[model samples]
Target: MAPAPSADTLGTSAARARSAVLEEQIREDPGRFRMLTGDRPTGRLHLGHYFGTLHNRVRLQDLGVETYVIIADYQVLTDRDVADTLTEHVEELVLDYLAIGVDPERSTIFTHSAIPALNQLMLPFLSLVSVAELSRNPTVKDEIAHSRQSAVSGLMFTYPVHQAADILFCKGNLVPVGQDQLPHLEITRTIARRFNDRYGNGGTVFPEPDALLSRAPLLLGTDGTKMSKSRRNAVALAADADETARLLKAAKTDSERHITYDPAGRPEVSSLLLLAALCQNRTPEEVADDIGSAGAAALKKTVTEAVNEYLAPLRARRAEYAQDRAYLHRTLREGNERARAVAETTLAQVRTAMKNHY
Candidate 1:
């Protein structure tokens, strides 16, 4: 497999895109606010979700931004060998989100399959987007190649367009994303620009959303690969203490018998240190320094203890919420309603501008 691109390259591209967005934002509105970010409901969110994306969303909610948590249920089929099990996966994801302090009242949590207006926006946006541009999107290409599917469905092919609908529906001006997802956000911005230029009643109908840069941690699995449910390399957020402990105990560490923070040569040790720091909001250097004179065994033990302790409260909250099916459904029901209210409004204006006249 080809090596992943270095952060230096990704950083340069991100800076350029962010500068362009910021220039437009200042000219548009100084205090403009609205955020859109979503997760693919392909499986239950793991520690990667918490350390990577969820925590940022929680912070955005606290900052008084209108946060929309979209479970891209429709995106699941884009790369599934068996798509029938998604219902349970989506439920577990919702429960996990709630357990992590994603308040539905402040954050609109809705599934992609339930939002009709957003899907409708996909139709016209699709018309405006070209096959070449979609094919050029790094994420769609990477996903298609990764899925190894013999024949990709049209829905899978146009997942980015659907994402544009997610942002445009809410007129979302900010998108919280990591480096890997910048390409997808770029596609969304391009679509927004194309639509506005073509049919944006006089002034641009859609404000191009900028990537809300997140200081996301690089999460790894037990095998030192990227954390993924399919690889069984992930520790689920809803996992009990015993489960988390077992996963951590089995986490891939080196035979050096000593811990070090050198990721260049000691990836496994670095991974464990990264995980511990993420769990406790400390720097890996800080954690390593605090583990002075404590060898590898002691370092791993301390990290494991810290992670398990941190997640204990989250697990309790998850258990309580998971038991109430009615509450889950009701929360989602209301969330979908709120999401649709905003989505339908933008979609209606889009229709009028495009002469769809629905």
Candidate 2:
């Protein structure tokens, strides 16, 4: 007989089952769901962001899910200082979203700073969770280690709670996240449940959001590490064909002459293969098979061509959007107003539930 599954395995299986159910429900009645997902205006979005989350966002939007994208500008202060370039990064992110088919008309896109009521939820949310729970959060620990700061900020410590506010503010029921992000979403679920239990008085306030696990695999950097703009190993979606080629040229690959996709034994080669496969809508193994015996040079060339070709239309659209700064700002303004209105309504409900609306 097979051995019993471990707790971790059971948890993963449960998440998968829940994700499948959510997907089916989304297909049947997308209007019944509200999705909240976004990025920090830290830097220009790269291929990782494009293939990982942006594509999925567009898919959900097209499926008619009411989407709320928060720019999380405040979150950036948790790790690094990007005050000087914050506005620039925000505008560029807007361009990427538009180019990638996230229609402002269909999906609301707003920044954290613009929604006061959203941030106000943080106070009550902070009271629900203990310091020990916050300290035990794996995501926060991982981020702190990655940031390598000598001293962590209070904001950074309570980052998960801030994320909770982001979700519950607009009553987001479906959050698109990768496996690694489950812990953060778990905290959000906990807060929602605790809030309702403590103050609901037979009325539930925030929906206990379920994770919509991302299907995309983690895309590594050209240097065979995590893809990040700070590392100078990422290929931004706004990069031109020449820039894309230049970046791909420096991608790490083994000395193996023959091309193959082996993520464990040959991560670098397989990463490039995966990049090309994602762009071409094919499997990495199929791509490696096509390039067998062609060598690393051939692999790099294929990846460069595939990435450039795939991003060509998006880059073109981004270029056009960048030309009209006024329109871009206007889009943000409208989204902020919409998000603020939603947040205000949710805040009112919270206050009434807690008898603090006096």
Candidate 3:
């Protein structure tokens, strides 16, 4: 529609585009954009895992918006208890983020356990948000259904409040989310407004966090189910060539002899093609056109190869970073310090707003 911003200036345009609301932001406050997003350090990241949300994080950081990656270790307890595996999972999660080129120096990457003030903010956040609100959170509902929880925990139910705290603690106004999480952020926005209505008289302590909906595709699992670790249908980012081949071979495809991209009718085949396209950074339609040039067997082989090659460097980097525990700890320590200071600033504002500083 507009003469596109040059490659140098495009980052400026793309950064704001992450949120539909953010698009209107540049017109109002061009330089005030901030982003927050992260994951529970529950398991290894897979191919279909966070790549969709993550690519946007990398690019947005390059575009000059403040970005934060919260390693939500405490959120892990809501669904299951991996008490023995907590330390390993947290460390691996950090390593995975590093291996994927999420530079901590540019972005603030910190663990939830490390920040006391932020956790303190969560208490006040929980007070303002009700049980009914928490119960209706799409993420919580999805998680509870997946956990098949007969009895849900207070922690699980309050995840959205913590999420609001995570963003509000950092004064982050923009969050990258998949379509499914839109409602969660809407909850966060409501809480921000409710908090402001109840709390803000001179000025709002919390920024009403907005959703930066990712343009990335929701990757389907190998069996055409959701690409989740629990389903055992995902391909881990750290998967080797042999593992990739095995998974690809085992992946469910259509009854037809050849491949096709009819998602409703041929979901399995379309999923495989989608995986291939994502690896090559192309589209399923483009891959389908090339299926004629390469044939079905060749398509599978090519797709598998493309995926393996794309992840090879990251896998290799993971091995290198894994060997250096001190390196990770050092970076994390620095990140924690930076994040703590930032959160403290927001908390100070919160205290002053509530007249609790005295």
Minimum summed lDDT over a 10-residue window in model 2 is located at 349-358
Worst 10 residues of 1 by lDDT: 22-31
Candidate 1 vs candidate 2: which has greater TM-score? Answer: 2
What's the lDDT for all of these models? 0.82, 0.92, 0.79
Writing each residue's lDDT as its tens digit, candidate 1 over 75-176 gives 777777677888898788889889988998888999887888888888888888789999888888877877757888787789888888888899998887
- Candidate 2, residue 151: lDDT: 80
Model 2 over residues 1-358: C-alpha lDDT tens digits?
A: 9999976678777888999999999999999999999999988999888888889999999999999999999999998744789988999899999999999999999999999999999999999999999999888989898884678889999999999999999999999998778889999999999999999886789899999986777789989998998788899998899988998999899988988888999988998999999989999999999999989999999999999999888888889988998899999999999999999999998888889433
lDDT of 3 at 114: 93
lDDT of 3 by residue, 303-358 (tens): 79989888998899999999999999988899899999988888887777778423
- Could you tell which candidate, 2 or 3, scores higher by TM-score? 2
Model 3, runs deviating above 4 Å: 1-31, 148-150, 293-296, 356-358
lDDT over C-alpha atoms for residue 59 of model 2: 98
- Kindly provide the TM-score of model 1 when superposed on the true structure, using C-alpha atoms: 0.90
**What stretches of model 2 exceed 4 Å from their correct place?**
1-6, 356-358
Error of 1 at 310 (Å): 0.7
lDDT of 1: 0.82
**Full-model lDDT, candidate 3:** 0.79
lDDT winner between candidates 1 and 3 = 1
lDDT of 2 at 204: 83
